[model samples]
Target: MSEKVIAIILAGGKSSRMGQDKAMLRVDGAHLLLRVYQVAVACADNVYVVTPWQERYEDLLPVGCQFIREARYEGDDVKQVETHGPLIGFAQALAEVNVDPEWVLLLACDLPNLEVEVLQGWIEGLENSRAEAIAVLAKHEKGWEPLCGFYRKSCLLGLNKYISEGGRSFQQWLDQNTVDILPDCSTDMFFNCNTPEDLRRRLL
Candidate 1:
């Protein structure tokens, strides 16, 4: 693909719902993050994992995959740094890796079945849509799938603006933007493991 694209795998969630780090959860004998990383490398020229605990996951990624450290409030005798939410991590990572790419493929690590075919198909769909949408997000009967989608560099300003205005909900932020919704709502690849039960039912 001549159109420059960067893939970003979000792995900085607190995983409080899972009671464990969902990114490290094994699926078919490999970490969920690693599986997502593999698919990303196949779809883009560059790939990055956005997280706060870079050291914890450095060895899990392939040789060339880079890390975009999530911006955290430095702590000493003061405030400390940690994962806040997907939007905050996304904004920080986008600033670091979005080097004038036509599109940015954003992914979440908990998606275990993300194949290269699925990813490439979305990129192709976005290209054919012929719309100047800032984002091309997945949609089903439920709602917009914001995490597993392609975003244009032009979206940076809007994302930052949303955060600046005290917006924390990604879904809420997306509702205000002009986004093309992809109708290939197959749960086979888009399903995410938010809890242990979800992990077993969807990924195991």
Candidate 2:
């Protein structure tokens, strides 16, 4: 059976620790953003790059996959930096689509270790379990990975409410909802690149 899902590539980050845009970083022959778009295409009917710097990635986004900017919606008082996280990106992504898509598969562009098999497993689990949300649990680690997860677009309402209440913890918002956790590999395969050294280690 076909599922009506959309993949929202959260690419609007400063990548301050990595000192560059992680989405533009290369792993294989393609840029990281393209690689992510490939993965998203494998499972989604449509995919989009949610970025604040659309110009920087205009060349990287796939021909058909759209580029939607988040900066356009930022309130006058909220600095760009203030709206730079995945939470803000996710919200903007939903607003741009303007539909409660069946599911939104979110992926952090710097997550080089995100295996397609694991992502497929999460999709299967979420579909089979019939849960409101399903996310990868950082096994043997301290937090839930809210970035690379399956969200029912409806969950955005609660998350938006959380933001209204000044809540910044993504995990906290997920914890308060009907969320299912998929056990992660012990080898830290879900590790995200946040530094040059991390990129070196993963690339080399």
Candidate 3:
């Protein structure tokens, strides 16, 4: 039996460092978000983009990609909705997923170098993943690369527990769970275009 897979792409970041919406950045004639979405579509059974502003990208994405409106933190102030980080955004999106996919591929919109073949290879190995593991992710010196990785759909229970208890850091939540290390791949594949200089380097 093949594992059913669904992909969730995170585009809810403020992009403070990039000085603009990273999803809308153009590379090789396609928006970065569209590029990542295309890769996800090729590798997974379904693809969903999670963000607060769905209308912003509805025109950019193709017909198959679905959108989940990320919730904003409401406060007493009528004009102030706190910007929760990616972990919360991911948790919310995962909770809203209608299908029971065995694995969920989580990606950031700014990863312009993502390749379908490499991701497919990774997906192929998920069936062999340790039963104790809640996620399969690449580990670098900094820590597990949570944004670009595979998480078990069943992990949402623990994820919600952590979030309800006020945990907001991906690294923190992942640290408390069992995770399998992804086989070594090219480091460039994980590169994030978060800054203007990073975008320039990506183009070059």
Please tell me which predicted candidate would have the highest lDDT against the true structure.
Answer: 3
Which run of 10 residues does model 2 get worst, by summed lDDT? 132-141
Model 3 residue 155 CA deviation (Å) reads 0.8
Q: Rank the candidates by TM-score, best first.
A: 3, 1, 2
lDDT of 1 by residue, 1-204 (tens): 345578988998878899889999998899999989988889988888999888889898877669987876656743245557998888888888746667999999999878787677777766665456888887776788888888887788999999999998888888898888776667578878998899888643
State the lDDT of candidate 2 residue by residue for 1-204, as single tens digits. 434568888888778888887888998667887887888888777788888778888777756668777874455665545545778778778777765457788877877766767667666655654454434344335767777777777766777888889887877777777666665546455678889999899888
Candidate 3: the clashing residue pairs are none
Worst 10 residues of 3 by lDDT: 73-82
Which candidate model has the greater lDDT, 2 or 3?
A: 3
Whole-model lDDT, candidate 1? 0.82
lDDT score at residue 21, model 2, on the 0-100 scale? 78
User: How do the predictions measure up, each by TM-score?
Assistant: 0.90, 0.85, 0.94
Each prediction's Cα lDDT score? 0.82, 0.73, 0.90
* Pairs of colliding residues, candidate 1: none
Residue 124 error for model 3, in Å? 0.6
Order the numbered candidates by lDDT, best leading: 3, 1, 2
The RMSD of every model to the true structure, in order and in angstroms, is 2.4, 3.2, 1.9
Whole-structure CA lDDT of model 2: 0.73
Tell me, by TM-score, which candidate is best.
3
lDDT of 3 at 35: 93
